[model samples]
Target: MESLVIPVLILLIVGAAVLLVARAVGRRTAGATGAAAKTSRGTPSGDPVETAKAAAAKLTEDQHRRLYALIAQGQAMAAIKLYYEASGEGLRASRDAVGALAAHPQPFRSAAPKVPEHDDDDAPERFPYRYRAIASKGDVTREVSSNMLNDEIYGRIRTLARSGDTEAAATALTRHSDISMKQAREFIALLDD
Candidate 1:
């Protein structure tokens, strides 16, 4: 038993060293290959949240307000059309953009950027509006609604979906909402469209 101690200690130190080296190599490789992977895989490079924020910035204050109003009213298709016409992006891209905006609400930023006056003086709770996402295939339909999901988080999920990482997207969806993996998959399937 005493003879076994030295070898076991050596093995533990070697294992820890190997793990540390592997993690360092993984970080280096991931940083070096991230852009290459995005380009090769046909996913847009750079931070998607910044990209989506830039896209949102293209909208004027009035257009931004109107878009949010449409989303708040739950007129998703109409909101998509509004964003399509406003952004001059393709239909599919517009759909994704609208979905992103809905999941993560952006306040209007203009030269002056006036805050829209609200009459609800009694309402104490502001921010974190619940957004609903609905997806259906064949006769099966699934809906996920959560206040925790925002445009930035949802944009990441959309990026995962666009990059053929449905499993990751589903995992993200499950993390953002109180849904099972199966339900998250169903919702993520709709996002790919």
Candidate 2:
């Protein structure tokens, strides 16, 4: 029994270390990109990891899960609203939270297109917005005017985005941005930017 004790202690220590590292990796990888991540950043000087972890910890389970889903779809406002609704504790607090959500809105990625990296220095020309779609269906074949990138549609898109319903937002934007893959990405850029 005494001889086995050392190995048992070693096993416990290894398990604890593995758990700690796993938690750290999970916190970072689980995060929503762009706006969701940025919104929780602790000032310019604060520790980003700490800030994000704190924010995630603060969220209730449902709001946290919804927030993760919504941020992916670029619906910052709706996510914020949902977060407030779920976590505000009571009626008056929740109502006040709604106003807070309206004022602050939700987060989104910036408007800049990610400039693709190159290996050889041939000086990459700025490629135009090429359409990118992993999948598409339904009546999204038609194109709409670009002017639909206005406030009203943006608000709708924000709501849709929070719900993780990009298709609906795309459909709405299609009423204004012409629904091609490039146009869809562009419309999202316009609204999110």
Candidate 3:
């Protein structure tokens, strides 16, 4: 009976220690998650516009949209590079800012600078210009050449590519061209870069 009592006490002590450890670990994890959530949501971080300005002071309205688009497409590295170049910030700061921006998107403060007044709304400039985009992987090569696609339009398409919405991007590409979905997919596949 005495031996039983000692063994039982030891078991209780071990169980109590385990419970204490688990509770401590849980509290630590919970605190960390809270901080992460706060960071991602931009609540504890303060006003989003200020954050955007501080992180990317030189980002024009169009650049801002394209950057966010890249983030949406899950092109973290490209987004970071774009931010870094646009903001003139170091790589690390750009990375952290990009991470936060991707987690919580911020709208463009003002209207996207009006598309230059065009005689035709669908077409920009006085005359529609033909632009060519080529993507090559292994031995397979794809080219998308269309007068309907300008830098701004292609930027939109590339943004869709970065955000991992190749289908939407492909659809947009086809809409801009006479190509079939298969050709659009082939072209969009090269656009991932």
Best by lDDT: 1
lDDT of 3 by residue, 1-193 (tens): 8879989999999999999999999999998887764433243444444565555445678888889889878888899989888877667667777776766666666544776554322533322678887888889888888877777778988899979999999988887766899999988888786
TM-score of each: 0.34, 0.22, 0.35
Residue pairs in clash, model 2 = 75-162, 76-106, 77-106, 131-182, 143-178, 144-178
Q: RMSDs, each prediction?
A: 27.3, 22.7, 19.2
lDDT for each residue of candidate 2 in 1-193, tens digit (9 for 90 to 100): 9999999999999999999999998787766333243332232112444334434545655666677677667776676667556554444333333344334443433345786774223332322343322222343342233443554545666677556776666666555444575566544543332
How many collisions per candidate? Answer: 2, 6, 4
Kindly list the per-residue Cα lDDT of model 1 for residues 42-115, writing each as its tens digit. 43435456445755787988889899999999999999999889988777767767777887777777665676
Query: Could you tell me the TM-score of candidate 1?
Result: 0.34
- Model 1 Cα shift for residue 46 (angstroms): 8.6
**Cand. 2 TM to true fold:** 0.22
Candidate 2: what lDDT? 0.51
* CA lDDT scores, all candidates in order: 0.76, 0.51, 0.75
